[model samples]
Target: MSIPKRVAERITNRIKQFQSILDAQRARDVSEADTVTLVKDLLSEVFGYDKYAELTSEHSIRGTYCDLAVKIESKLALLIEVKAIGTELRDQHIKQAIDYAANEGCEWVVLTNAVEWRMYHVLFRKPIDKQELAQLNLLTIDTKQDECMERLYLLTREGFVKSALAEYRDRKEATSRFMLAAILLHSGPVQTALRREVRRVSEMLVDPAEIDKILRDEVIKRECIEGEQADAAARRVQRSAEKSIRRASEECEGSEANPNPSESPPVQDAH
Candidate 1:
């Protein structure tokens, strides 16, 4: 999900320059038309879309119009539904865009208000499902953060042309297994392996049932990585924990050297 150095720099600068202004406008209730134009500008400047080509607003499905579409080599890739900047994206909004995608045979549909972008994968299989693959909230994100940019990069024109978003979804699904492994409650392989490790490290023999009980109580701390998001915050938590451990270790060394005087080990009570 890494963007090219040049592309990343451009996006970072654009967000830094425009986010506050956009926020002020959105606070005043910008019109849908204006939001759509902003979305196009984001596509062109941040996502690498050529405004004249590869991006279109005239796309229609069975005479019904989608707000925007991205095409590669004359093939429609995704349909987008734009709402006013302050609009809350709902399931109905997503379904509307998905209906457009399905009718047009487009595999992806996005619903956004220039503030929050949500991407869905349209499954063509029976019992049709619109699975949400990713989402980004521009309002709260720090664009300079690597994890933030990585997710945002998936929606770029180069990303869409190269199927980077799809690849990102696949990678997320695969990595999700590890996250599940960390917190599985069932007697799954992950749980079994963890129990084995616990037994190996325990001072006394540990029972599998004990591990199950402990897990049911959910006493073990775990960090969850959602979708394609990086574990950046988790790393911060780990560093803090390591610092506390080192401080404790240093205190213990000092205590040992000075020998906390409990009257010098009861002073010679035997005397």
Candidate 2:
């Protein structure tokens, strides 16, 4: 999880306790109140939130109350929307919490029941988008799973205090965009790399026009450039395309002038 020694210890205990809670639920009826209590416990025990100072339950925002809200250093940091135990959390639950956060000008929210936790980044661009950062089941994880533990750390008090989740989300988004641009047709960086790779591994040389056609038809199906995001790579991609076309034209002319050996090879066959 890249967490300090103490936070790692806390995560181990939290995972074990959560597993025990689910195991005991084999017979006991778990109510919404029970779920809320569990959430509070996790906030205090696992995440290290001070029950009295950092956690607020039934937090009201303009008359609409969410299950919990977190405050750190007198600044509102996160809002949590709780669903009842055994309830299947869905997009509607996320939207509701996001709406509440929007009203409060909050950027982060956690939507969870007693068993599952889903963290989201509320993108308030034009239409608000709930971009999920991570989700996991408390009942299904190993105590020492590093991947899951890192995700869990995103919501921990020590993590939030240090803006860990925020940084994690930003890094993730940046990586995603880079990947999209790499495979996407309108990415200059990837086009240049792709040309080099294609020439390096193959005997056949293809032009950028053919590459674009292939990428558009066979490779990239998702729209990578949308709204403001297009501005980042559009110009570069256009320039690449243009340069590619010029090189392709020059290659075609050279090939035509010095035709292939199979077609016409300096009259060597006459010898």
Candidate 1 lDDT at 92 equals 86
Distance from true location, Cα of 61 in model 2, Å:
1.1
Candidate 1 Cα errors over 4 Å, as ranges: 177-271
lDDT of 2 by residue, 19-126 (tens): 787656523757777777878888898888998898887678888778889988878899998887678888788888898898889999999886789999998876
lDDT of 2: 0.79
lDDT of each: 0.76, 0.79
Error of 1 at 107 (Å): 2.0
**TM-score (all chains, Cα) for each model:** 0.66, 0.78
